[model samples]
Target chain A: MKKHNYSAGPCILPQEVFEEASKSILNFNESGLSILEISHRSKDFVAVMEEARALVLELLNLEGKGYQALFLQGGASLEFLMVPYNLMKTNGKAAYLDTGTWASGAIKEAKAFGETVIVASSKDANYNYIPKDYSIPTDADYFHCTSNNTIFGTQMKSFPNTTIPVVCDMSSDIFSRSLDFSKFDLIYAGAQKNMGPAGTTLVVVKEEILGKTGRAIPNILNYEQHIAKESMYNTPAVFAVYTSLLTLKWLKKLGGISAIEKINEAKANLLYTEIDRNPLFKGTVLKEDRSAMNATFLLENQDHQELFDSMWKKAGISGINGHRSVGGYRASMYNALPLDSVQVLVDVMKELEKNS
Target chain B: MKKHNYSAGPCILPQEVFEEASKSILNFNESGLSILEISHRSKDFVAVMEEARALVLELLNLEGKGYQALFLQGGASLEFLMVPYNLMKTNGKAAYLDTGTWASGAIKEAKAFGETVIVASSKDANYNYIPKDYSIPTDADYFHCTSNNTIFGTQMKSFPNTTIPVVCDMSSDIFSRSLDFSKFDLIYAGAQKNMGPAGTTLVVVKEEILGKTGRAIPNILNYEQHIAKESMYNTPAVFAVYTSLLTLKWLKKLGGISAIEKINEAKANLLYTEIDRNPLFKGTVLKEDRSAMNATFLLENQDHQELFDSMWKKAGISGINGHRSVGGYRASMYNALPLDSVQVLVDVMKELEKNS
Candidate 1:
């Protein structure tokens, strides 16, 4: 059976990327040595690191924009700590927009360093919408926000025009849509969704924004040190970085973000259209704030939950069960999810409605 | 031709592990979804994480000792910061043994937290031998040391007896040899070496040693939080953890640490014996302190460098070039490296001598 993996993260990547990555594990680059066994500093692997970093900038169209792309380990959670350590100064303040769990988590870490302020929060309504009417304090070291909340199915369509350096956690929705990436001082995403697999995190930071914090930041957490070392300060996640390079290559060959954006929109629209139109189901979040990457929806009658679950499982759809916080279903339509899979999901929903 | 990979950390894993891991990337556990696409929360992957953690304890004989095994990211370098964050108390001090590059790196991070005392250092002699006659400060929060120095090819034969919590970075040596295992309160190793690949790190810490530090550790860096969360504090390196599990299963099937320890010793002895007897080459580090995992050696005549280098390359040998800091050849024979490969490398050394 063909499985349509809608996993939130460590999610679906391009099939070609998987094939290449799988082959590399056995014999990387025909070097007769598995990618798993090669040194991160080897010329071949170094090319992978360099290409991955370069392609990130190229895909984001941030070439020559004073941004350094680093493929680091520890996922975006570590970035939560690093962002404050590198950006927040001594006794400094940071403004964060609380949209969902990850945003609150980031704010939690920033509080350990200095004063952390929540500019606005949609938590009152279970984070069903992106809070747009938030003001960033100009004095705050940086205004941080989660571009897309994977759990709540909310995405900030337009970022606030901020003078204080802007940092965005694009963990789930990065590279799925076109954005003016240069507007943010730093953007980080775990490579599980839309990028690659779960071992690495992509950190694209503007060089000028660093080194101003004056905090005694640990070398491992310091962005400038990682940049100076060309992301080789320590042994990087070699397999993860190489697999990300393969993914980035897949994205580039598939016409970059602009091309994937249309496909993603189509996939999200197909499933969301079925949810909103079918009398048996409804969309979970506000229409405007609904994430194009993850579409959360619920059956209109809780009684039909068993039937709906069985139908999707029979249809070979996996990972559609919504996060426990938000009950129902979440169809994560990342870049690699084909429109055909979404159509299959929509067909299942229609079948459920007919059965009801 | 089969290649002999000795790339140092991020080095060799078993061929069976490579095959299994490669297959999982395409379709995990006969499930139509790639392991790369599966959720960490999924029963299958959760099992991987659980088994990997348990196997670490089981293999190390630490299971009944109240130690929690965690698979983390950012490598041992990040653990350099995390160890102090979770162990060193506010305004407390730490005692360290400066063995080689990684030990010094750990010491550097420890200094950022509080007072760090170096009880002994082998740096006066280019880290050719482990410093044994040193007193660890009883007042220190913990005593730290590197079990093996990958770059300098030195290994600690004995650890200092101390009442303070003993922490060891066994990145290059863990699982390759059998130790008392209970002597150290905390042991961390980057998975790239004998474990699996370059992405996740294995941290086995005694539960009693945590949370005593009055310092407010960020949740991500907090070992207790990770332990509480069952090592899935956030999205783990799903693929890395899974691959490490595959490697662990391989180790277990092959008789775990005690069994592999014998094989590792044999491989190390084969190469070291050749380096000793061959007139053309000499070992770099002191004989008493030579590492079984990584053997460093130099040509007796530097003029034969080009010839020896070519001979190894032609014989399908790779990653033997020594680190720049230590300008000699380093052959890292981690647990997965078979005795046959060591014989091949030894054969190359003899060939070089014949040519000389």
Candidate 2:
């Protein structure tokens, strides 16, 4: 049976990327050394680091724009602490929009370094919608936000047009769609979601926003130091970064973010349409803010749970079970997910409706 | 030419470990999923994590002991700061032995969290010898030491029998020797050297030594939080940890540390004997404190440098050029290095002497 992977990250990456990564692990560029064994400073791997950084910028359309991209160890969870540690100015408050658990986590870490103000939040409604019509605090150090809620299935259609520096955690939906790259002062993502594997974090920062905090940042956590050394100050997540580069190349070959966004929307539309019209299920998040990345839904009748689960399992679906926060099912249709797989799920939904 | 890898980390791993790791990256345990794509929480990877943590305890002879093992990101460099953040009590002092670059980096980070006292140092002698007969301060929160200096080729032959908690940075020499497992309160090692690759740090902490610091540790850096969560506090370095498990399994099959130590010592001795007898070279560290992991040496005359370098390159030696701190050559004889490779190097040294 062909398995449909929806295991929200360390999720689906291109089959070719996996092949190339596997081959490199055996022998990297004919160097007679496994990518796992070679030093990051070796020219072969230095090329990999440089290419991975360049591809991150190229895919984002931020190339040659003074935006530096780095691949560092510690997942996006650590970036929650580092973003505030490096940018939250002394005695100044950073404005945050708490949309979901990840956003709330970001806010918690930011509060440890300086004052954090919740300018807006959708947590009150179980984070089913992205809050709007909130005023920006002009005196805030920066405005931090999560672009997508993976659990509750909400994504920001438009970002705040604030005057302060804009920091975003785009972990789950970074390369799945097109974005206005210049608008963000800093962006971070755990690689397991949309990028590569779980070891490294992808950090893209506009250089000028740093150094205003006046606090001495730890060398390993300091973005400026990492950029100065080109992300090799400390030993990096070499295999993870190399695999990410391969994924980026595959994305580029598939015509970059704009091309993939169309496919992603079609997949999300397929699943959501089935959920709405099938009568057996309903979408979880607000209709307008429904995530094009993770299509979350639930069976309308609780008694149908065992049947639905058994049917999905027999059909070879993986990771369709919903998170504890919102129980039922979540089909994460990331970039590597083909629309055909979504069609399979749509077919599964139709079958479920027919049997009922 | 067949390459002889002696690069100081992201260094040599067992050949069989590399092959097994490569196979798993393609299809982990016949799951038809790349190890890179599966969720860390999946039973397969959870088993990997549990086995990895258990293997660390087993290799260190700590099974059934109270020490909790964790695999984390940001390498040993991250552990430098985490050690003090989690253990250095409020307004308390931590004592550090200044051995080499990594130890100095550890002290630099520890100073940020609490007062750091350098109880002993070897900087006056260019770090050629491990400082001896220094007292560990009893009033200090903990005493920190680097068990092996990768750059200087000096190792601590014996640890201080101190009453306070003892912390060790064993990045370069772990799994290559036998140590008294019950001696230390905390031990952290970056995985690139003898264990595995570059992204993860292996942390083994005595459970009772934590929660005394009173400082709020970030979720990613907190020791107690990681142990409580069984080291899946976040998406760990999945590939690195998986690879490390394979290496540990290989170590166990080779009869664990005691057997590897003999092979390591023989490799070190083979190269050091040539350095001592050959007219062109001389060993760097003191005889008593000489490292079995990294053997640093110097050419007696700079005029023969080009010929010697070309000869070694022709012999397919990689990364023999010593670090700038200690000029001439270094052959890092890790657990994975076969004695035959060291014999090849020794033969080259003899050839150079004959030519001279």
Candidate 3:
């Protein structure tokens, strides 16, 4: 049985992407070299890096618009520090929205580099919904927010238009849907979720916005340095980046982000409908703000927990167990997740409802 | 004929390791999930992280020691900055030996956080030899040096026993041979060489040595934070670390570092002897300081360069080309490189000599 993988990041990648990547691991580009053992500086892997960067630009429709793409390391956690180190200047204040754990983590790192203000938050509501109607400070250097909260299963339906530069942590829902890519000055997504594997972080930065921060940014942490080197400032995560290129290739074939958005919406709708309609289940988070990437839900009747668990297990479903903080289920409908798997999950939920 | 991989890092791994790792990418632990897509927090991957950490200790004979092992990202490049940020106290000086390009790069980052002194340097001679007779300052926060200059093919003959904490960038020659595990307070190696791949960096630090530096280290760059989180202070380089575990398992099955050291020595001796004896070739670095890992050589007569290049190419050898800085050939004989492969290169050298 083809199991539904919903364990969040490092989560589901396209099957063909996995197959192609596995073949490359055996012999990359017929070089008789495993991708895992090839230098990041080699011509073969260099092509992979170039293509990955170009595709990121194409997918975002930012090519020639002066947005540079960088595949970096240390994941989003590292980017939390890097975002501020590169953009936040001396005495420069950046506004951040504290939506969930990840946003809070980013805010914490930003505070170390310079002054950071939490302009708004949903913490009082336990981060069950994305906070909106927060005014951006025009004097702030940038506004930082997470597009999707993986743990909370809440997502910003639309980005706020503002005069100040905007930096986003789009780790969980980056390529799953289409967005106005030009609205933000900087965006970083850890590749574990919708991007690729777990090692590389995709950083898209406006080329002109750098170097104004005044602080001597560490070469590795600086966006401008990474852009100048074309993301090869150091030995990059070769396998991760190569696999990302493959996944991006898959994404393009699936008609890019626009097409994936429809598929993602369908999956999310199917699952959410089941949870809302079924007497035994209830969807967490506000319906308007529920993520198309991660859909969190719970059993209305806690007594039916064993039945729900066994049903999903029997249906060859995996990774539907929600985050420990949420304590229910989260059927992540990432781009690669087919509607068939969502149907299987919905049927299981409906069966539990009928029996219970 | 099978090609001999000497491409430096992500250089070569045991062929079986590649095969097994490729299989896992198809289906990890029979979980019907690709290793690339598996959740890092899952039990299977958690086991991999723990095992990789344990194996680092076991291979170093540091089991039950105060030293903690971390598989991190940003490679050794990030560690260059991280080392200083966490350990270099305010206005306190640390000593460094400028050995080669990488060592020089490390020096650049060290200067960012605190005072750094270059105690000795081999840069006077294009870094063809490791600097010696260096005196350490008793009051220095740490004495730092690169144990091996990969591009120049120079290896440190011995570490100076010093009272101040000794930090070393052992990126190239970390596991090729065994050493006294207690010598350095902190040692970081990029995994592309002997360990595994390019994304994850291996950090070995003594627990007692941290927090004495008296700096407010950022959570991500702080060695103590990484220790507290078991290197999960962030979402780690998952595939890189898992692949590293497989390589470590292979290393352990082959009797750990002691067993691999003999193989490494044999490979280096075979290649270096040819480089020294062949009329068409000459070893680049000082013989005593030559690395068992990367053996750099040049054509004695530039007129015979084509013949030497063609001979190696015909013998199914790859990645033996030296770095662009000092170009001729750099046959990086990492631990996974077999004696047979080195012999092929040796034969190629001898063939070039006869042809010339």
Candidate 4:
């Protein structure tokens, strides 16, 4: 049976990426060595690292724009701490937009460094909408925000114009849409979403924004050190980076973010249209702030839950169960999810309405 | 031709592990979903995380010893910074044994926390041997050392008896040998060595030793947070951990460390004996401190370099090139490296002498 995987980040990557990654595990690049067994410093793996870094910049259209792309480990959670360590000064504060769980998590880590100012938050409304009209403190070292809130199904359609270096955690929506990526000084994403698997985090940082923190930073957390080492400061996640490169190559072959954005929009629209039109369900977040990558919806009547669940399961649709915070379904339409899968989900929703 | 991979940390794993891991990437556990595309929170993956953690303690004989095993990212290098962050108090000092490159790296990170006392160092001899006669400071918060030095090809024969907590970076030789295991309060190994792949790190620490540091530690760097979350404080390297679990299962089927220890010792002895008997070759590190996992050797006569290099390449041997620190050959025989592979290398060395 064909499975439509929509379980948020670490969700779905291209089928071809999975096939090549699987084959590489047995014999990487025809080197007669399992990808898992080869050294990270090996010429073959080094090319993988270099190509992955270069491809990330190329896909984001940030090539030759003073940005260095690094595939580091520990996911975006580590980036939360590293951002403050490498960017925030000895006594300087950081302004953050508390959009959702991840944004607030970043703010929590930044508070450990120095003063952290929350410019705006939609938590009072349970993070169902993107909070606009936020004022960035000019004196702050940097402004931080989450590009997409996976759990709440909210996304920042437009970023705030700020002079201070902007750091965006694009963990869930990166590579899913087209944007002027150079506006952010640092853009980070845990590669589980639209990028690749779950082991590596992609960090794209402008060279000029680093080394001004004025505090002694640990070499592991310092962005400049990683750049100098060419992301081989220590042994990187070789297999994860290689798999990411495969996924990035797939994305590039599919014509980059601009091309995927159109397909993603179609998938999201197909699902959201059914949610708005069908009498059985309604969208979760405010329509304007709804995430194209993840569409959250709820049953108009709770009695239809069992019928809806079984119908999707019978239709070979998996991972639409909503997060604990929101008691509904979330259909994550990442770059790899086909429009046909979303249509199958729409049909399931219609069947549920008829049964109810 | 079958290749004998000795790439040193991210070296060889069981061939069966590679086959199974490769299959899982396409469809995990008959679930019809690529392991790469599944959520880390899924029941199947959660089981993987649980099994991998349990298997680490089980294989190490650390079960019921109040030791918590965590699969983390950023390799042992990140653990260098984290060890200091989570262990060393605000005003506390740490005692370290500077054995080789990785040990010195750990000591360097410890210096950022507070006073780092170097009890002993073999730097004068280019780390050719482990400095054994050293007194760990009684007042120090903890004692740190590297169990095996992959670069210099040396291993600590025995650990120092210390009342203070002991921390060891067993990255290159964790599962290849049998140890008291409880002697060290914390043991961290990057999974690329004898375990699985190069994405996740295995951190086994005694539960009692945590929360002693008085400094405000970031939650991301906090061991307590990871333990509380069952090593899923963030999105874990899902595929890496699952593959590691597969490797650990293979080790268990091979009768665990004590059984593999005999095989590892035999493989090491087979190659070391040939190195000793052959007139063309000489071992790099001191005889008494030579590592069983990684054997660093040099040509007694420089003229044999071309002949030996060509001979090994023709025999389907790879990754024997030594690190720049040691200018020669390094045959890393991790647990998964069969005795037959070492015998093939030994035959090549004998052939070189015959040709010479």
Candidate 5:
């Protein structure tokens, strides 16, 4: 059975990227050395890091700025703790937008460091809508927002325009859209979503935002330590970074973020439109706040949820089950997910509707 | 032209492992979904984690203890902070043996959280050998040591046997040999060197040692949190962990750690013998203290370093260059390095000796 992956993360990656990465894992660049064994500092692997960093900046259209790109270990979860540890100064407060599960996690980690003000929250509505009109405190060190909520399928389409440096946890939506680089002081994403695989976290931080946090940060958790040492403060996740670089190269060949955004938007629309039009199903997240990365919906007849799930699983649809916390269906439309895959999902939904 | 991969890490892996891992990356388990796209919470992945954890215990021959195995994100670098966060609460002090770079890192992080005592240090000898004769703090929380110095190529053959809990950062040499697990209260290794890849860190800790640390630790960094959640406290580095699971399974099939130890010993002897026999090169670390994982050496003729490097490079040998701080050569003989590869390196040295 041919299966189409719709998991929110550790999600689909480009075929070319996988092929290239697989070859290198066994014998990197025909060096008769496994990619896993190569030193992160070796000229070959250094080129891998350099190219990976460059591609990220190139993808973001922020190549020359003082922004330092790092391919560090620990997923976005570590970043949750690291963000505040590096930026939260003595008795400093960081504002966070509690959009979904990941946002809550970020908030939890920050609270351990210092006071964190929840600028906005969508939990009241079961995270079906994005809240607006939250006041950003001028005194807050920085504002943190999750660019896209993987579980809730809500995205911050427009970033809050504030003088306070904006930090984003774009674990899912990065590289699926275009953004003005000037707005974000720091941006980080776990590679499982739209990039390559798990194991590497991409951190893009403005060089100037660091050194303000007076707290003596642990070197491993300290972002400035990584920046100053160029992410080689220790041996990095070499294979993951190398695979990510290949993915980034693939994205560039596809005309960077702009071309992918069009594909992503089209895929999301195809799934969302079917959900809205189909009487048997209803979109979970508000129509205005529907995500371009993850389209979530619930079957009208809850009893048929299992049937729908079983039918889809039979149709080779994997990871369509909504997060257990949010019981429904979620079709993650990351960059590598082709429109045809989404169409297959839509076709499954329509056939079920027709049979019913 | 073939290349030999001698890069320290993200280093060499078995060809079979890469082949199997690559197949799954593109179409996992014939699901037609990329392994990267699967949810860690999914039954398939949960099985991977469970099996991987079980294999670790099985390989270590540590069974029927109140111990927990975790596949954690963040390298041992993160654990440098986490070790103290979870274990340093009793307030007397934790003893650490300062071996080399990573040991120093752990020491630096431990100092920030609580009182840390350096019981022994090899820095007096420029980290060329492991220290001997150290007073294990009688009332200390735990004793810590780096098992092998990847940069310096030294291994501690015997640990300081004490009543107080013993913690070790076995980042470089984990499966390289067999050991009595009862001696150490805690052991952790970053996966890059021996098991698989660089994204995941393996932690084995006795459950009782946790929660004694009075300091409130970040949930993700907390050992208790990972234990309670079975290393699923957060979204883990899924693919890396999965690959690690594959490697563990492969290790078990190859007769576990015991079989690999003999092979490691043999390979290390071959290279070290070459370094000892040849007048052109000399092993850097002391004879008895040399590491089975990383073998460090210095060229007698420094001027011919580049010539030797180019020759090695042409022989498909990669990552043979030593650390900039050390300025010589280091051929890391990690667990995955085949004896044949070592023989090839030895042959090249012999040819070089004859020609020189």
Candidate 6:
């Protein structure tokens, strides 16, 4: 069966990246060594770390302000704690925008460290839209926001222009679009989304924002430790990093984030248009704040849910089910997801509408 | 050139394991989805996590016990902090043996949480061998030790026979030999060495030892939270876990750890015998306490260091340099390092001797 993947994370990747990454895992660049076998500190592997970091900066367009890119272990979950542990020390209060489940998780971890003031919350409306018109606390140490809500299929289309530093968890929508990164002091995301796999976390932090926390953060959790050691503080996930570099390389060859954003926008627009035009389906998230990364919808007649599910499965479409927490259908169209895959889903939706 | 990989961690894996792992990275289980592109919450992925967990216990012969194996994102570095956060609230000091770098790291993190005692330390002699006649403090909550010292090339031939809880970091030499796991309350290892890769950490813990900590641990760092959720507490390193399972499956097919132990013993013996018999090279660690995983050696003439290095590199051997802290050569004969590679290194030693 020909499958079109719409998984939220551990999501789609370029074919060249997959081939290049797989070859390295087998025999790294013909070094007669598997990327899985080499020490992360070795010259070859160190070069990989360097290139991966360099490409990340190139993708972000923030090259010269001494921003450190760390490829650390522990997914974004650990970063939720570490970010607050390191950045939430001064004034003991940080402003957080409660966007969805992941944002709530970050807020919970930050609260454990100190004070967390939710500047804005979308929970009142079941997180169908991004919250608006919230005042940022001037006394807060930093403001935290989840750039894109994976479950609710909502995104902060434009970041809040605030005086306090902005720390964004861009786990799902990172690298899918270009943004003015100068607006963020810290940006973190798990690689499962648009990067490579699920082992590593990408942390882009302004060098000046760290070292303020008086708390003795464990070495592994401290971004400063990884930054000082060039992400080689301990053995890194060599294969994941290698594959990530390949993905980054693929992104670079495809004209970087600018080119990807256009493709991503096109893909998302195609699917969402199909949802709005089709009577059988109803899009879940607010049209104004609809996510350009994850397109979620539901069958209007719930009785046909199982039938629609079976149709998609037999059509070789996978991971289109919405999060169990949300419970309809979610089609995550990440950077590597081709337009053809989205078109396939749109075709399936149209066919379902015609039969009905 | 044929390379002999001796990178202590992120070490060698069987060629077959790499082949199988690489296939999944491109197209997993013929699902036409890159393993990197699948949702961890998907049924296919949940089964991978379940099988990987099962395989770890099966390899350790820990089935039917009250033990649970978790595949976590943070490497053993995070375990240093998590061990204390999960089990240190007994209102008593945790007893730790200072075997080497990693053991001391655990002790440092434990001190941050509660009272911790350094029961014994091999550091007095530069951790060249395991300490003997260590007393487990009477009121200690747990006795922690590092099972194998990757840097110092030492091993604990036998564990302390005590009624108190025993926690061990077996990152360097796990599955290299049969272990009496009955004595261990918890055992964790970073999967860079003899296991699989570097991103995931394997933890086998007795379920009853947790939830005693009164202090609130950050959710991501809590073992009890992970156990209750069956290691899917968050998005895990799915690819690393799958690869580790492939390695475990390969281990089982080769007749489990016992069969591998004999092969490991022969590989270590072959290298150590050459180091002992040859006048050009001298083994670093004590003969009795020599590690079966990494065998360290130093040349008699310091000037010949480059000569030895070039010889090995020309023969396609990489990562043979000893750690900078200890200047010499370390040939890490991990589980996947065939005895033929060891013989090749021995042959290099003999060739060096003939010229000298």
Quality class of the docking in candidate 4, CAPRI style: high
Error of 2 at B168 (Å): 0.4
Question: In candidate 1, which residue pairs get closer than 3 Å at backbone N, Cα or C atoms, i.e. clash?
Answer: none
Q: Positional deviation of B11 in candidate 5, in angstroms?
A: 2.6
Clashing pairs in 6: B10-B192
- The number of the candidate with the highest DockQ is 4
**2 versus 5: better DockQ goes to:** 2
User: Candidate 4 on B1-356: residue-level lDDT in tens?
Assistant: 98988888788999999999999989899999999999999999999999989999999888999999999999999999999999999899999999989998898888989999999999999999999888999999999999999999999989889899999999999998999999999999999988889999999999999998889999999999999999999999998899899989999999999999999899989999999999899999999999999999999999989999999999999999999999899999998899998999999999999999
Q: Name the lDDT value of residue A267 in candidate 4.
A: 89
* lDDT of every model, 2 decimals: 0.91, 0.89, 0.89, 0.93, 0.84, 0.87
Which residues of candidate 1, in runs, are more than 4 Å off?
none
TM, every model: 0.99, 0.99, 0.99, 0.99, 0.95, 0.98
Checking candidate 2 for backbone clashes, the offending pairs are: none
Summarize candidate 4's per-residue lDDT along A1-356 as a digit string, tens digits.
78878888789889999999999999889888888998888889899999999999999999999999999999999999999999999999999999889998999999988999999999999999999987999999999999999999999999999889999999999999999999999999999998999999999999999999889999888899999999999999998899999999999998999999999888888888998999989998999999999899898988888888888999999999999998799989998999989989988888877776
Query: Which of 2 and 6 is ahead in lDDT?
Result: 2
Model 2, residue A24: C-alpha shift (Å): 1.1
Q: Write the per-residue lDDT of candidate 5 for residues B1-356, one digit (tens) a residue.
A: 54556667766777678888878767778766666667888888888899888888888877778788999877898889888888887455888999898899899998976788998888888899888887987888889999899889899998877898999999888887999986788999988878888788999988878887667888888888888898888778787888888888888889988899999999998999899999999988989999988899998998767677777766777677788757698898887778887887888788777878
DockQ of each: 0.90, 0.76, 0.84, 0.91, 0.65, 0.78
Residue-level lDDT tens digits of model 1 in B165-277: 99999998998888999999999999888888888999999999999988999999999999999999999988888888888888899999989989988988898899999
Q: Where in model 6 is the C-alpha error above 4 Å?
A: none
What is residue A152's positional error in candidate 5, in angstroms? 1.5
- Given candidate 4, what's the lDDT at residue B229? 98
* Total backbone collisions for each predicted model: 0, 0, 0, 1, 19, 1
